[model samples]
Target: STRMRFGRGAASPAGVLRAIASGGGTDAFRLDGVDHRDDAGRLEVLATEDLAVEQIGYADVVVLSRADACSPEALRRAEERVAVQNGAAAIASAARGEMRGPSTLEALLGLRRADFVQTTPAKATHHHAYESVSLTLDGEVDGERFADFVETEVARFSGRLLRTKGILAVAGLEQRMIVQGVADLVEITFGEPWGDAKRTSRVAIVGFGLDVGSLERAFTTCAAS
Candidate 1:
């Protein structure tokens, strides 16, 4: 596992990118409560400014620090917003830098090219240039139908869609399915069983100039009939 951290008062985006280029490893960004401020004064770990938002897009994993101080609603909103900015990035919430287990650290440090394939190397650019959308579906879905939907989506969206990943409940399968797509290439494989976890589908799509509503509706229709 490889890891690098950027302090709260680190250099600018250009400097960070330069460091990353030289460092030659996976990058993870930790956002804290002090960095985020909303209408309710300062919501710890729930709000972020331009710099943090931009970093989220470039990171392989994003950890929301000081989450214990934030309200449940605030944390939910923050997760939702972060999901839309970098759908492929693994997200987790921590309190005082303490996470559940080593798995969280592994998830943050693990760099899989197949999981997050970038169309273009990250550089200092406008934050709003790209967008990410996350979708959640309950119940099982038809495997073939889901595959067809992903194929069509990648074809239609083409280059604009940087990456897409999901944990799906495929009909007639005891184990969960992990789907990952980079541009036009997509892969689906079986993961662990549902076990005690809730059976649901969660997906994240990252790209530029996406019609999120249309994509969401199209994905919904792919559910098992």
Candidate 2:
């Protein structure tokens, strides 16, 4: 990540190289070392910026640490990377205790229509369907089956997924429900219909990680009416 660049006012390459060679990790990148008056007066570790964030884009695992808020530029750059990586990275704050504490599935109980934020891959795309729909898996869909379907879909689209959300109408459940996922995490919830009228039981699956044609096909072909 280290790179050589002439400072704004200074033209001596020898001095910059000498400082870089002698400076420790902390001293190597310091605001004081770089002339504060001008923005481009110090050597920077480009890879440290790259290494600052890590992204995980798979089912069965969603690990987000607290190192995303390094700086506005850093976080902004990291987010851009996340969107491009297509759901490989989860939105996180590098500052400790800055979030609403650690995440727990407790909030997902009876949840429906979840919205996702950002990721490490910055440019991750998303999918949406406005019409009401339902899912009819043969018998019941185990966690493994659902994960497999999602993984296949992610790969098929090369990781363009940001968030997935929709209502799931189960054959046996008393009330309509919701299911959602961000990055690698997924959840299902139960809830009453939004309106007094009974909502059409439908499954709406959205994707940002890849072309949802396959997902749409899968749901349409397999879901129960």
Candidate 3:
């Protein structure tokens, strides 16, 4: 977790500071539509629009209140801008936790997690495919072979493929490993040991403009034995 400051207008920040100083758990740093006045009774305002991501990135805490983190469209724009400019900034969404859309799957696929998030149907510019399959075999796998399988299967349906993530078991390793692939980039890491819950490998593939049947077949045939 990163420490960062929040930027708000007028009494909103002061109110938030007051709440925090008083040991009250306030939801956000908003003035609730009230006119903001400073200690001298003059309007207190910050240059929010003029502040660049670089400035917001330096605060140990950031605040958002009310409609700040509301809709999916807003969330998307905020995420894109923050990602490109504020790699080290932390965010505080004051609009409550009502926004929902992105999931662990999307995060894994996108290669990063977003705080204020929402989801809508993907655009038509690209093909997308998604499928979940379970592997019954409990044998150890050759890492190279597994990697090759993932790459080739994804490529076979590349026209529509966007992302794929799964956990696999190798014949010798007691613990399973994780695999994440996005377009042409793929990564693998050691994960927790297979639990008793299912003891099977699960895979989900998402592709753009790709046929689901073809994507499924690609994985089914990937093992190099």
Worst 10 residues of 2 by lDDT: 34-43
Q: Give the CA lDDT, 0 to 100, for residue 6 in model 1.
A: 72
Task: Tell me the TM-score of model 1.
Answer: 0.57
Query: Distance from true position, residue 143, model 1, in Å?
Result: 1.0
**Predicted candidate 2 versus true structure: per-residue lDDT over 33-126, tens digit per residue:** 1111111111122212322112122111222233433555655554443333323212333245333333444332211233233222232222
Of candidates 2 and 1, the better by TM-score: 1
Clashes of each: 1, 38, 28
Candidate 2: list runs displaced more than 4 Å: 1-148, 151-159, 193-209
Which regions of candidate 1 are displaced past 4 Å?
1-55, 58-60, 64-81, 93-127, 196-198
> lDDT (0-100) at residue 89 of candidate 2?
19
lDDT of 1 by residue, 17-135 (tens): 34433344555642111122122214223224565554555454566666777787877766655555676775566676575333544444432222332222222235356677777
Cα lDDT, model 3, residue 146: 60
lDDT agreement with native, every candidate: 0.59, 0.35, 0.38
**C-alpha RMSD of candidate 2:** 15.9
